[model samples]
Target: MDVPEALYLPDGDGFTATALTIGPWDAAHQHAGPPAALLLRAAEQASGIDGGQTVRLAYDILGPVPVGPVQVRTSVLRPGRRVELVEAALSAGNDRPLMRLSAWRMRSRGDAAPATPLTHPAPAGPEESRPERAAFFTTEVAYHRALEWRFAAGTFNGPGPAIAWTRPECALVAGETMTPLQHLLVMTDAASGISATLDWTRATFANVDLSVALHRPPRGEWLGMDAATVHGGTGAAQCNALLFDADGPIGRSSQSLFVEPR
Candidate 1:
């Protein structure tokens, strides 16, 4: 079989997941990134939201999304001239939703004042970094392989915080160009795994939900994350990341984790 060039292949009203969607933890399931991006793509294409941009996105992972055909349904939850709420759901066949996303889209005032001066300086750009692979990637063809990773601060398997730059090697869907938010969303879901503090072999830390808030549309192909995970001993954990582009800081992302010993 030939390897797919994109993460997903369009199928009717749904999409077919390719090997590129597989995560490090499972070959049969998909990493949250691609599916999240798909949901956002659906929302962005939905009617009545043409003039606005998504400012916030929250995802609830109901279950492991199987690596196969999945349907995406999007609707406008609350309509407004200045702001709107959009919802999207992904499901396999008639099964319950595997993931659900709610997004807030707001109109941009092009006449607004300049953005506040960036307090924290930008991290080292991708040109100043070296390429590295994630230590936890066990599968030959997985989501990890779909991105180009260049670390500016920490290694993939190293404990504590990490600062890294990532760019997608392929499109989210074949024949489609990914928007800036889609690019950022596809990389933000890995914040917890890349910045894990627990031993990968001894324990499992999987994020149950992901939320992102952006102050401005990210620019450029490379997106940066300064990420860290905090485990609270009681089987619950939180991961946070300051999102960036080559120009400067753009937003923040966070995930709620379900931690357990293997």
Candidate 2:
């Protein structure tokens, strides 16, 4: 499927979205339907913001989104004078909320006050490394054409840290134009958890909650992700990542994951 067309799926109703189940995790795809991406699009469309502008998107996965039909409902929390605040919830049967998201829409204020560039060095590009098919990446994630991902280090057996590079195939979805934030959101899942990537051969991981923050828009189309699972012991794990553009680091994302032995 092409990037634009692949980003969303068709519900039995007129509304189209990404199906609850797609490649890799077997769970619903994030930012697919009733996901963060859908919320952002609905807000933009409602507020009459051309999908090309900048809007901050955040998602809180309260629980598993279940595999089945879903619907998205959006509300404008506060249509501010300078900024617009919007909230979206995804529900299955009876409108039970599966995911709740809020977006901050505002006109670009341009660059921030000048400061020294002290970000970390850029990681190696995906092209420099050899390509390998991850069981999750190729089958579950459905990222085949959207990104050129390479697992820098990790065993296929168990939970642990993993590194990979991601570059978007298409811009992002917002009406008629693509935005940089869409690229960041699409690749945020590249290498999620540490325990899940370990070579132990008997661990499983699923993101319970995830969020990404962008400091500056991506300079180039290609962005790299360096991710690690930090400290999680009591049935929970946290995955953190730094996003890098050609110039330097641009954003970061982290997720709280549920861990168990398969």
Candidate 3:
């Protein structure tokens, strides 16, 4: 069998997180991004589409998903002709839940209506951009190595707002065509990293959940995020992003963050 360059290796029963999927802390744990995208893969399968596009995805990171063998199960919670809601759960063993997700797939109403209020302009293309190789390029995790990043505005692993163009350099699951939805979902988690508000040394912020809403299926392979992070005095932070395709604005994403002193 051919090797996968992306996040997971597909097995007979389920999939396993590779070295690329390692989290910020340890090699044994996976970053929320790749695992969340994997949940979308399962959700898309269970959605039964009937005809709609996946418009929204919400993921709750139940606990640390140990890096290695993991099983994902997706089911339709609410089924409809015009709309469908599907959910996916990731478990490693003993039925212990690691992550849960809910996705909404909605079909076009065939109404002659204008789409988004405004389409955000995409930044410069990735060709004119630079790869992120900062001092914070600490480890060579599978997820970091698996993606090709091009920064247009801000710097990654820094304290500032950022606009970046991103593309998955590898496959999500072996042999499975990485769908546009899967591509977009994975990038949403990186929004926080692209636009960080706190010092990584003094404080650590890990997202507890990710939520994304798309107006339409993105066109082209490259995706972009005009991302920002806001910290509250109370111990919480929010990462919000305006999502765009190579063409124009498609949707938005948000992450709830848990902040702590490192």
Looking at model 3, report the run of 10 residues with the lowest lDDT sum: 133-142
Error of 3 at 65 (Å): 1.2
Q: Write the per-residue lDDT of candidate 1 for residues 197-256, one digit (tens) a residue.
A: 988888888888999999998888888899999878899999999999988899999999
lDDT digits (tens) for residues 109-182 of candidate 2:
55757745956543456566546544544244344444555554553234566556555543333233334455
**Model 3: per-residue lDDT, tens digit, 128-174?**
87778434434655456666788889888778889888887778887
> Which portions of model 1 show Cα errors greater than 4 Å?
120-122
Once fitted onto the true fold, the runs of candidate 3 whose alpha carbons sit more than 4 angstroms away are 1-4, 109-112, 134-138
**Which one wins on TM-score?**
1
- Model 2 stretches with alpha carbons more than 4 Å out: 1-5, 10-23, 27-34, 47-56, 66-69, 137-146, 151-160, 169-178, 193-201
Best by lDDT: 1
Q: What is the Cα-based lDDT of residue 204 in candidate 2?
A: 60
> What are the per-model C-alpha RMSD values against the true structure?
1.4, 4.3, 2.4
